[model samples]
Target chain A: MSELELQNKKAAAFVSTETIDGEIATLNLGPTHPATHGIFQNILQVDGERILSAEQTVGYIHRAFEKLAERRPYNQIAPITDRLNYCSSPINNMGWHMTVEKLIGAEMPKRVDYMRVIVMELARIADHLVCNSVIGVDTGALTGFTYMFQEREKIYDIYEEICGARLTTNVGRIGGFDRDFNKEFITKLRAFLKEFPKKFDEFGALLERNRIFMDRTIGAGPISAERALSYSFAGPNLRAAGVDYDVRVMKPYSSYQDFDFNIPVGNDGDTYDRFMVRQQEIRESLKIIHQALENMPQGDYHADIPSFYLPPKEEVYSSMEALIYHFKIVMGETPIPQGEVYHSVEGGNGELGYYLVSDGGRTPYRLHFRRPCFIYYQAYPEMITGSLLSDAILTMSSMNVIAGELDA
Target chain B: MSEFATKIKDSILEKYNNTSYELDTYGEHNFICSKNDIHAVVEFLKNEGFIFLTDLTGSHYPESEGAEFQVVYHIHNLAENVRFRLKVDLAQNDLHVPTLTDLFAGANWMERETFDFFGIIFEGHPNLTRILNVDDMDYHPMKKEYALEDETRTDKDDTFFGR
Candidate 1:
């Protein structure tokens, strides 16, 4: 407590002080901070470290993906989809490809349909793991996060075993998986199925009754059904608000109607509800994966249209027709009949939709992605109102705002 | 079908099935109404308890002479547990529509995104600033005509690309 030390501390505090519209308190919370969950900046109008109003400033990672997709062929848009929700690329890939399929009237085989269901459910589980674990980390329970990340890493291994790359897995071709699943992949997934439940249970027990975590989350960001729907919130965020409107159940795309599972609803519609709904969804996804594996049909993985998809290399070397078809698909010169289709799937986050338009050309005439995160994150301020600054991190993690998907 | 979606679609069809607006039944609950009746139909849908505006998106056809844009609005009714589609068509030059933020708060950012990509303007949007694009950027990136000219086109501040 020397005079020089006290003055230096006072000077440091004074240097940090600034005016915003004549009001003197302001604080910058991350373009680089672990608590941000992603690369995002929030300029907070503050009063003694208590947030008055938080103005979120994003687009630090805006890649202009929609513009990039306009120039590329509709088939090539799969890679761009990979970038949107980089945490769950398979879901985005399948969603974008399904839109194209709907436009062209392309029918995938029943086996491929089952395979897609399995992979997407696995992605859903992984996404929930991160959301749930990060909720724990934000609430100061690092042990719970370690348990969940281990299960998530197992899921990532399965993804890598299925596709060569783990994170940005551009797994699907335009119609179906680029390659068929082997026995080894199935064995690894079954092992994850057995181990995941135990880890999930242990993590749940650790946080569900933890007084501090519950206090932070229970009523932290309570939004009503009216507000949630009006904000265009989707996926777990909307479901957690007691909407009971799962797009899979409401619209039933990709033969999701055939799968039997409950759409878990949360009555309170708070941060705790959002977290709980996602946790419940992990079990539901496991159920879907089990069913999909059991009921998988035996047939071709891709459509029989050789001109649109590549022929086998053996056929290409042996037959002139196969070579010609190969050349056409590679050049993206294969003609698609002119039409438009809006295809949507219940992504782990929300409704991941693609509105595709074609002029019978190689490239998409126009492509618009109805990203759920963008809509949900736009309403972040409304959710965080009257809550402490720390609650912002918990609210974001509960809502699971992936910046890639939100910005795209 | 829930009475909410059915009555709303029937009411619109009964009232505005004229030269300007064409009504096509896409599914049992889903009906594709013409662009002209979009404002009226949306108002009816909102008043009739089909309040949740789930999604608003666009599709473009370059070959079409005047009509190119097909915009769809997916709506839901939480009370009745039903969903429906409302649609409008826009000519290439006049890609403008009334903002739905008055009806649904969620439409604000969705409309801004639609504007950012398709270059369609919402007539009465409160804050119609770019959500994804920087304030300085000019081109509507999602329009059919906006193409990637070169590698330098990736840079956002160097707006001189394609110039």
Candidate 2:
């Protein structure tokens, strides 16, 4: 057959030709597939191994968190924010707090800003570890994943030291942390910083240049920078497309301007490039953390806002002033100015933003979370249109579409 | 407004006559346009370097006379690192605005999400189905009229506690 004839023949095979060989099969990827790791279904129209089209059904885990946010006070919303991107909850927590602070005009201390940068960067590392290792696991490299989890748990240990919570860490308060970073947190952070690179590099060495890994991901589900920006891709996904649009550099928040770090970029927005960009971003995050810690200011960890800060239990019991302040703090009765503010942070996979609207009430009038996973997942059908089944799964994993954020 | 904001405002107003802008509650630029010209204004903004649509969400204010339903679009210009917010408000009866999917492919899901939450219809959307809500849901849950409390609860009846 001629080249044109073969092309036409393959095109006929995809259409409804009324032959058993040319039959189109419907495959349900998941509302609960083990590969998906979350509760959302993609009804894929397939011709044998390659996917022709995919229609997704999200909202399986929709908790109506936004509507719920409408009834809760500012401080009470952090716990809810933690659930949006569970892999990097501290960033979400801090993003929400910062949005509220922008509304109330709370000036954070330099020390508070540096402390937040430290916690946010650690959360970024933790977020990337789950995503990139899962990419390795999908590519049949489980050992790298298993080892990376150990490093991720060390991050979780650091979180436990600071916030006393592991996964959904509502790490910091509005102006800053509830308490200063204790000696144990500092020591554990120092130790983790020293030891993390060795394990991380080992994991990278296992898969970064491996022939099999590259073969699986190098050309699978590639998206161009124009399409990526049109789809509103953010964070590492957008960076992988070579836009170099990191929120930290584009619009520095939480004193990110004080630190110096590189914004890693990749040419093709494929699974491989996404994985590599995240890998390099982990290094960049470490650099930012080092900068923050080295220049850690010597003063209060949180800002001096009496109403915004919850008083100590001992102080609340003895002093009348502390008692009233504690009541106000617990009730979230600080006189918040009626305003709208939007603040974003560079999250694990992309930009996580919080858009807040207050009506001079105890609760927020409206709150919207610009979840990167939710945005990136919109381009999934286009990305995996003609890819193999395994590559589709790899693309999904590489995108890191957390169901909580997607259905939030 | 800053000189740059005046430039942006004047540029948009130059092409489209019926448009206005003011500093939002956060002291950021918020351009308001009629629902009919939202598509044109957004296209103008896109041409003016506000191409990256960071967010598109809807809000409801039942008491606000003409703006019972408001759709907010947050766009960013990557090159200049500038952010702009565009708002298109619709009355309670005529809750329709042209879909931005043509200009921004990402607006599809966001439009569905806004429609699902606030029931503001996005005209010409390819598939305007409920995104983050169940397909069979009757009411838009984000509207203020839908009380957060579960009305079916048996405990703590106001009549039993008081009069």
Candidate 3:
């Protein structure tokens, strides 16, 4: 046969006259698709309604955070961290602060630690609420998403009371918080504590045992514990696989050891298990917040490091020492110790680690963020290979692959 | 160093006598091994219960002659709740390192990312291509020689931003 004829015959085999109507199709679940919550592309090779294979293409929103962190000062980098995993921005801020503190060996006071616990738990609640509600929306249950989003707004209100910003909250300082939790902040938190559980339970009752929801999610996108661990899954996703690995429990930081809670795990490691694990985690986070508020300690909010922490604005205007310190800090002249440290925190999604390498300079020589979503999203193609097209959307929502964190 | 880390260090020292390696501690134990022995050392650590590969990233050191690129691996032993770092330094002229994809499938994109940013080639990566950056770009952006911000912008002057 001629070369052209040979090529035509091979191409014709895939779409023979008999099989043309039932031929496999290629669907570009492109970045602009609505089902993909964030800006990411996945090309799915589907045979009718079933996806035969999937190829993910991320980096649609890569902002190069690691490169930016190397140039910014240690204190200035906290705001940059806020952009990562913006659903739980405060957790990112606190995690970055703790990483720098670890590098400097600065110990925070008990009160500071407790306050951080409260803020971080609230952030966790907000993050999980979004994930679970979005999963509901993806599964054709829109009312629950609307109902839970109100609770997310309330959590944002609490964040606003603590920090001026709501979503990307640059809340904490290097050693501790920039300000104390005010009386209004405490009242709002108490109100949220009093009312959130009832709403959470109502939301849970709506989907937890509903026949249709269960049928849609029970065995959808299942991963074995061994496979999940091999992919370095963390946070609720790993727990859903029955590994029982919680960074807060394993290597406690920011007074997490003092709080009492259970790490929820599931057997099937399916979408339903991931949803249940996050639902259980919401209750656990509430318990931790209540404990933290009740046992709130008495001390300064921020550490007394003039060189690292900025002084009050009034003091900076009046005192020569404060003014010099302010200039030095703003100009990125603060001296950092020559060392390296890796600090991991139990973020809303998983283990959010900041690896810092300092050369006794004003800025970090290298700062690498171990973003959990980025790692876990790598397993999405594997998980969704044999599942249906609709099930892939549910799995993506269940995985909660926040683009900010994934492409950072 | 913890007992497990000590044991791993002793094993590496015994197995690779001619190679130069260093042990450093900051927050976790770090074993900086020679470039050629990284795959074997990581395989050895995996056998030693460091089953979870937590992270894989690369750093650039422009001034460090003969060793300008460093690949850092963070691995953990879940049973003991212990974590350690393994680093292998690569020379600038020869930026090739053996791929870890055969051992841990999660290293696929990370190695691509390392290659994307630092231009450190993972020799046996199944699909070695640009991950985060556009494929047509000629230079690695993360190396120290590149500017942090875009220099082409005329809107924000250096003095205005206090640079």
Which candidate has the highest DockQ of all? Answer: 2
Query: Which ranges of candidate 2 are over 4 A from the true structure?
Result: A1-20, B1-4, B152-163
Native contacts recovered, in order, as a fraction for each? 0.69, 0.79, 0.69
Q: Which of candidates 1 and 3 reaches a greater lDDT?
A: 3
lDDT of 3 by residue, A1-408 (tens): 532254345445534533425667899997977888889899887767766667789899999999998888888888888889999999999999998888877889999999999999999999999999999999999999999999999999888988889998999888788788888898988898999899889999999999999999998999889889888899999999999999999889998999999999999889999999999999999999999988988889988788888899999989999999999888888778898888899998999998889988778999999999989898897788667889999999999999999999
| Candidate of highest TM-score | 2
Off by over 4 Å in 3: A1-21, B18-25, B150-163
Cα lDDT of model 3 by residue, B1-163, tens digit: 5677677768777997644445544546777778778898889878888888888999998989998999999999888777878888899999999989877877888888889999999987778889888879999998999988788889876574435
lDDT of 1 by residue, A1-408 (tens): 532254345434533553233443777888888997898788765555444566677777888776677667667888889888888888988888777777777888888888888989998988888888988889888998887888888888888887888888887777888788888888998898888888788888888777877887999878888888888888898889998877788777778878989989997789899988998998899899988888888988887766677788999999999999887777677878786566789887988877665777777766778888888887776666446778877887888888898787
User: Model 1, DockQ value?
Assistant: 0.38
DockQ of 2: 0.56
Which residue pairs clash in candidate 1?
Answer: none
Q: Is 1 or 2 the stronger prediction by TM-score?
A: 2
Q: Which ten residues in a row have the lowest lDDT in candidate 3 chain A?
A: A2-11
lDDT of 2 by residue, A255-293 (tens): 888888898899999999999999998998999999999
TM-score of 3: 0.94
